[model samples]
Target chain A: MNNVLVFPMIVPILAAMLLLFFRSNTAVQRWGSVGAMTVVFGTSVWILQQVMLHGILRLDFGEWLPPFGITFVADSFAMLLVTVSSLVTVLCLVYAAFAKDEKRESFFMYPFALLLAAGVNGSFLTGDLFNLFVCFEVMLLASYVLMTLGGEKKQLTEGIKYILINILSSWLFLLGIAYLYGTLGTLNMAHLSVRIAEAGQPPLLTTISMLFLVVFSLKAGLVLYFWLPGSYSTLPAAISALFAALLTKVGVYALFRTFTLLFYHEPSLTHKVIGYMAAATMIGGSIGALAHRDVRKIASYNVVIAIGFILVGLASFNIEAIQGSIYYLIHDILIKGLLFLLVGTIIHLTGKTRFDQESGLIANYPLFGWLFFIMILSLGGIPPFSGFAGKLFIGEGAIGAGHYGLTAIAFLSSLFVLYSLLRVFLIMFWGESSILSKNQIPLSKGMLAPLVALGIITTGLGLGMDYLSPYVSEAAHVLMNPDVYIEGALHNE
Target chain B: METIIILLVGVLVSTATYLLLSKNLIRVVLGTAILSHAIHLLLMTMGGLKMGSVPILGDQVDTYTDALPQALILTAIVISFAVTAFFLVLVYRTYQSTGSDNLYELKGPQDE
Candidate 1:
C-alpha cells in the first residue's frame, strides 16, 4: 500500500486547520495556504509518477482487507485529475491572495478554500461509495460557507436555493447507496463491480444506477442545472472561479467512475439516457448563453455547455471518447478557472456586469484583451489550443460509434460557444470607450499574473499533448477496461 | 419488523414532502430534517431487522446484525444535523437582510 496517496488530501486539510489559528493574520493565511497547496500539487504529481511506475496503487485504511475495508485507489485517471485540481487550487489561492478583498479574507477564506481542495482530493481518491458520499458533503459544506460568506442579500437568496437543492440531492444519493448496499451487500467499488458482474446486473440495479445518475446530474449541472447559473452568477470572482473549476467536475468524475467501472453492462439503457440528457443540456445551456446580456450569466452558461460536451464523450463510451474526455476535463478545469477570473476581472474593473455596459477596454488593457481573445479561441475549440484535440477526438469517437446526430450537435455546440464569447468580446472589449478616465481601474500585475499563468498552462497543455498522451491513454485504457481498475483495486487479478 | 419500518419510513417521507411543498422557509428546513430522519430509518431497515444479535462479539451465535448501516446512518445523522443548523442560520440571515421569509417573495433577484 502506497502512503503517498494520502498526502495530497492530508496536506491541505492540515494546512486548513493551521490557517484557522492565524485567521486574523492575512499574510500568514495567504502565503501559508499557497505553500500548502503547492505541496499538495507536488504530492499529487508524485502520486502520478508512482502510479505510472507501479501500476494502480491502493491504500486500505487500518490494514483491513478488500471488500471489508475502506480503500483509496490512485489510478492514472484519479491522479491526473488530482494533479490538475491541485494546480488549479494553488492558482486560485494566489488569485485570492492578491484580489485584496479584506472582508472576504477576514472571513477565513483560505481555510475554507483548502478544505474544499482536501474534500475534492478525497473524493477523487476514495474507492468506497460511502466515503465518496462523505467527501461530497465535506466539499458541499465548505462551499456553502464560501458561497454565502459575505451575507449579501443576493448571496443569501441564491445560496439558500443552492443549499436546499444540494441537500435534496445528497439525500437521494444516500438512498441510492442504501439500496445498493442492501442489494449487493457491499460498498467497496471493486467488490461491487465483481458482484454486479456475478449477478448479471438485474433490472433493480439499473434502476438504482438511475438514482445515482439523477443525483450526479444535479451536482454536475448536466440537465438539472436550473440552480447552477443563478448561484454562480452571484459569487465573487475568485470563489466563483474555484467553484466553476472544481465542483461540477467532481460530480462528472463520479459519473465517469460509476458508469465506466460499475454500470457498463446496461450501456443501451444508461448511456442512451446520458446521451439524451447531455443533448438537452447543451441545447438549453446554449439558449441561455445566447440569450443573456449579463456577462457572468453567459460565462456560467458556458460552463453548463462544457459539461454537456464532456459528458457526450462519456455517452459515446469508447476508448477514444474517454481519452478525449480526460484531455478535455483537464483543459476545461484550467480554462474555466481562467475564464471566470477574466470575466470577473472585467466586471470588477468596469463595475458593470452587462456586455453593453462597458467598451474600449482593449485601449486600456491590451494584454487583458489578448488573454481574453486566447480564452475565446481556446474555449471555441480552435486548432492549436487545449480545447481542440479533445473535441476532435470526441467527434471522431461519436462518428465511430455511429452517432452522427450527436457528432453534429457536439460540433454545433462549439460554434455556439464561439458565438457567445465573440459577442462578449466584440461588445465589451473592442467598441468605443465608455469609462471615464478617472473611473478606469488600472489592472494590477498581481491579479494579471495568475491569469497569465493559467493562459500559458492551457496553451502549454495543447502544445504539450505529446507528453500528456501516454498518461491520458493509460487513464482511458483503465476506464475503458474496468477489469484493470477492478483488479487493481481488489488485488485479485 | 422490516415491513413495519419500511411503512414508517414511507409515512415520514410523505409528511416531509408535504412540509417541503409549503412556501415558508422554516418549514422547508424542517422538511429536510424530517426527510433525513426518514432516510436514516430506511437505511437501517435496509440492513434487515432483528435477524441477529448485537454486532459485538459475545456468547456463541450463528449471526450478528450488520453494523455498517448503523455507522453510515450515524454519519448521515450528524451531517443532516449540521446542514439543518446551517440552513436555519441562512434562512434567518436571508430574512434579516431581505425582510421576507416567503419563498415567492425571495424568488427573484432582490439585490441585483
Candidate 2:
C-alpha cells in the first residue's frame, strides 16, 4: 500500500502530457524532458532508500487484495534498475537536445520518450504477469515511433522488421500468459510462484516456461537478436543509445524475474538451455563484432556481446552469479550508453560511418579520444573499472557452480570485446587525420558533457563498489530467495 | 464447441504463415493482422466455453463462465488493432518512398 512506488511510473506520464502542450517550442520540449527524467531519477533513488529501510513495498491499485487486483512491487532489484535507467535517460535527453532535427523535436519526441520511460518503470515495478505484458507494449509502441520518426528509407525498412518481430514476440507473450492463466487461474506473480511450487513444475509448465524464454530472449537480444543491429544502427545517436541502454535491459530484467521467481524447480531443463543460448550468443555476437567495419554495426554488435555476458551469470544460477548478473547489468547499461554516444559523436564529426573512411580523431579531439579509451578499458573488464567487478563475481560464481565451459567462454568473450574495441581504437584514433578541418563538424561541449558525465559515473561505480554492493547484494538476496518477495507481496494484508 | 474453435484457430494460423512467408509487404502486414485475430480466439477458448450463467453474480446462479479471458481478449484486440493500423501506415509510407512493395527490394545491406 505504499504510495511512492507509483511516482516513478506516474511522474513520467504527467511530464509527457505537460510536454505535449509545448510541442512547437523545442526549448521547452528538451529541457522539460530532461527535467522530468531528473525528477524520476530522484524519486527512484528515494524509493531505493525506502526499500533498504523498510524492505519490499507493493502498491495495490484501488486497495484490492493481491492475486485479484493489479500490483506494483518495489524490491531492491527493481528500484536499482529504475534509478539507473532514469539517470541514463536524463543523459540521453541531454544529448538529444543538441541533435538539430527540427521535425524530430516538434513531432512529440519528448512525450514519446517520456512514455517509453513510464513503460520501462512500470515493467520494473509491476507485480503481475499481464501487467508486465502491457508495460512491454507501452515501451514497444513508443520505440516503434522513435525508430521511424524521421521516415527515411533505411529507417523505414529496418523499422518494419523491428516492429514485426516485436509484434510476433508479443503475440507469443500473450499466448504464454493465456496458457499460464488457464492452468493456474491467476496472473499475480507471487501467487503463480506459490502455485508452481505446489504443482511441482510438471512437463507442461516447463514447456510454457520455454515459450516465455523465447519471447524474452528475442526481446533481450540473447540468441534471437537478428533485428537488433540493423534497427539500432538506423536511428539517430540519442534515440539509438536510449534503445541500446534501456530496451533489451527490460527484457533481461523480465528473464531474471521469471526464472528466479516462477520457474526455479527445473534448472536442469531450463537453466541448461539458457546456458547453451548464452554460449551461442557470446560466440555469435563476437563474430559479428569482429566481422563488421562500419562503426555503428560494430557498436551495435558490442551491445549483443554484453547481453550474452550478463546472462551467463543467470545461466549459472548461484548467489554470487546472480549478484554478478546484477552488477554486470548495471555496468553494461552505463558503458553501452557511453559507447554509443561516443560512436555517434564520432560519426557525427567525420560525416562517415565506416572506420576505413575516418582516422586520427585523437589529433583533433584529445578529450574525446581519452574518454573513448576509458570506455574501452571499462568495457573489457580491466581492473579499477566497472566491468571488472561484475566479471570477477560472475566468473567466481560460475567456477563455484562448476560450469567450467561457460566460465571459459565468458572470459574469452572479454578478450573478444577487448580485441574488437581496441581494433577500433588503434585504427580510428592513431592514423593521420582524414577529414579536413573545413569539412569536419566541430566537437561541441553539449555533446561531450553527457559522455564525460557517464565516464565519471562508470568509474565511480567501479571505485564506489563498497557503497553499491550492499544494495546489489540485497537485490541478489531477494532474487536468490524468492520467499522474501512472495511473503511481502501476498501477505501484505 | 471448444474443439471447433481450436480447429478454426489452426486454420487461421496456417493461413497467416502462408501469407507471412510471401515477399510482398502488404501480404506480410495482413498476415500479422490475421495472426493476431487467431491468437485472440485461442485466448478466449483457453478460458472454458460457456460453463453456466452470465458473469454477473447473483444468488440464483450456480455457476458462471469465466470472464477474465474475455477482458484479456478485449484488451488484446484493441492493442493488435492499434499496432496493425500503425503497421499499415508504415507499409504505405515505405511504398510511397521506395516505389516498391516487395520485401526483396527492402532487403538491407547484410541481406545483400
Candidate 3:
C-alpha cells in the first residue's frame, strides 16, 4: 500500500504549498514546477504498476470506515486517467517554459499548474460525491488563474465568461449533491450506488441524475459548448491545449463514473438521452470546427467532438461500448495533447495562429511540419495511429451493441474531423513557400522534446493496444459489476 | 413552511439568472452571488427543515435541526465567498482594461 498511488495527489499539493514561500526566485519556481511534475509522473507509473498487480487499491482516509468520511479509490480506470493527466502536464509544463511570457510567469503559473494536477487526481480518486465537487472547484479555481494569467485583454474578457459558467456549474453541482444526499442519505459513491440500486428508479434519483448530467455536460463541452471555443482560444497555446485535453475529460470521467455505477438502472431513459446528446455534440462541434480558421478554436471544437464520442460510449452502457470509450479517452488525451503542442509550436514560430495570415511552414521547418502532419492525421483517426485505434474500438463497440446507426454516425464524424484537419494542413504546411518567411525565433529543445516524445507515445499507443486491451476490459468489468465496489465501500469497517 | 422557503429560493434563483443574463459585468457577478446564496438555502431546506433550536449539545435538546446540511452549507458558503472575491477582482481588472462595465463592449476582434 505504501506505493505510488498516493503520491500523485500528495506531491502536487506539497509542491504548491512549497511554491507559496519562494516568491523572489523565478528559477526556483521553474525548477520546482519541473521537479513536482516529474515526481507526479513517476508516482503515476508506480500506481499503474500497483493496479496491474493488485487489481485495484482503495484507501479510506485515516482508516475511518467508508460511507461516512471521504475515501480515495483507485481502480484500473482512475489510474489510467491519472497516468494520462500527469503525462500531459509534464509535456505542457515543458512547452510552457518556452511559450509563456514574464507576465504569465508572475501569476504563480507553476503552482496553479500543480494545483490543476492535484484537482484532476483528486477528482479521479475521490469516492465521495461532495469530495468530487471540491475537486472540481480546485480545478476551476486554478483554471481561472491560468486563463487570466497574462492579463491579456482577450484573456480577461473570455476568462470572465469561463469563470461564470464554471461557477454556475459548481453551484448546480452542490445543489445536485444536496439532492442526492437527501435521497440516499450518503455521499460515498459506492454506497450510494447500492442504495440507488436497491431503491430502484425514484423521481428524486432521476432529478439528481439529470442534474449531474447538466453540470458535467457543461464541463465536458457538450451541445452547449460555445463558451469553450471563445475562451479556450484566448489563452496561451500550452494552457489552451492542456485545458482542451484534460479538463473536459474530467467531466466525461464523472459521467462515466456516475451512470455506470450509481445510475445504471434507467438505461433506456438516461443512456438514450446521453446517446442523442452525443450525436448532437458531434455534429455541432464538427460544423463549428469547419467554420473556424484559427488553430486553437479548431482544436477546441475537436475536443467537443471527442466528448460526443465518449458520451456515446457511456450511453451505450454495454461492456464493449464502455471499454471503447475508455480506450478512446486515453487515446484522445495523448493525441490531442500532441496536436495542441504542435499547434503551440507553430504559433510560437510563425507569430500567428490563423491559416490566412501564415502559410508554407513545411518548406522551412521540415521536422515540425512532418510532426504536425502525423499529429493531425492521428487526430483525424487515420489508420496506424492511436486516434484510428480509438475510433475503431468505439465503432466496434457501437456495432457490437447493435447500434449500427450510432456506429455509422461515429464513422461519419471521424470523416468530418479528417476534413477539418486536412483543411488546416493544406493551408498551413503544404503550399508554396512564398506567403511567409521561415520563423526566425529558434525553437527551444525543452519544448521540442515533449512534442517528439508525445509523437512517439501516440504511435506506440496504436502499436501496443494489445497490451492495454486487457486492462481496459478489466476496467469495463469493474464498472459493469457494482457488487465489488459496493462491498468495498460498505464492508471496509 | 417548506413551500414558503422553496418559493423564496425559486425567486432568488430566477432573479439571479436574470441578472446574469444582463449586459453589465458587475450585475452578472452580483447574480452569481445571489444564486449561490439561494443554492445554500435550498440545500439547507432540502435536508427537510425542522422547527427546532440550535444544533448544540445541551439539556432539553429534543428538536435539533439537521446538522449535516448546515455543516455542508457552511463549507459551501465559505467557498462561494472566496470565489466571489476572486471574481470581483477579476471584474475590476477587466473593467479597468476595457474602460467599461458592459460585457457586450468587451467582445474582441473575433466577434466582429
DockQ of each: 0.85, 0.75, 0.70
TM-score of predicted structure 2: 0.98
lDDT per residue for candidate 3 within A1-493, as digits (tens), equals 6335568888999999998788667678877887898888888778777777866677777767787767888888888899888998888887787665666677688899899889988999888898898888888889889989878888888898899999999999998987887777788999899889889968779878999999999998877797898898877767877898889999999999999889988888888888889999998988988898888888888888889987778877887778888888998988778877787777778778787776677887777788888887788778677877667767777787777777777778888888888888888888777434433566677778888888888888888888888888878888888886666556643
Greater-DockQ candidate between 2 and 3: 2
Q: In candidate 2, which residue ranges exceed 4 Å CA deviation?
A: A436-440, B110-112
What is the overall TM-score of model 3 with all chains considered together? 0.95
- Deviating ranges (above 4 Å) for candidate 3: A2-5, A435-439, B50-65, B108-112
What is candidate 2's lDDT per residue for A349-443, written digit by digit as tens?
Answer: 87788887767889888999999999999999997889989999999999988899999999999999999989999988989987676776788
Better of 1 and 2 by DockQ: 1
Better by DockQ, candidate 3 or 1: 1
lDDT of 3 at A90: 85
Candidate 3 or 2, higher TM-score? 2
lDDT of 1 by residue, A1-493 (tens): 3877889888888999998999789999999999999999998898898899889999988889788989899999999999999999999889888887899898899899999999999999999999999999999999999999998888899999999999999999999999999999999999999999999889999999999999999999999999999999998889999999999999999999999988989999999999999899899999999999889999999999999999999999998988999989999999999999999999889889989877899888899999999999999988788998899889888788878888888889889999999999998889888776787788889999999999999899889989999999999999998899988999842
Q: Give each model's whole-structure lDDT.
A: 0.92, 0.92, 0.84
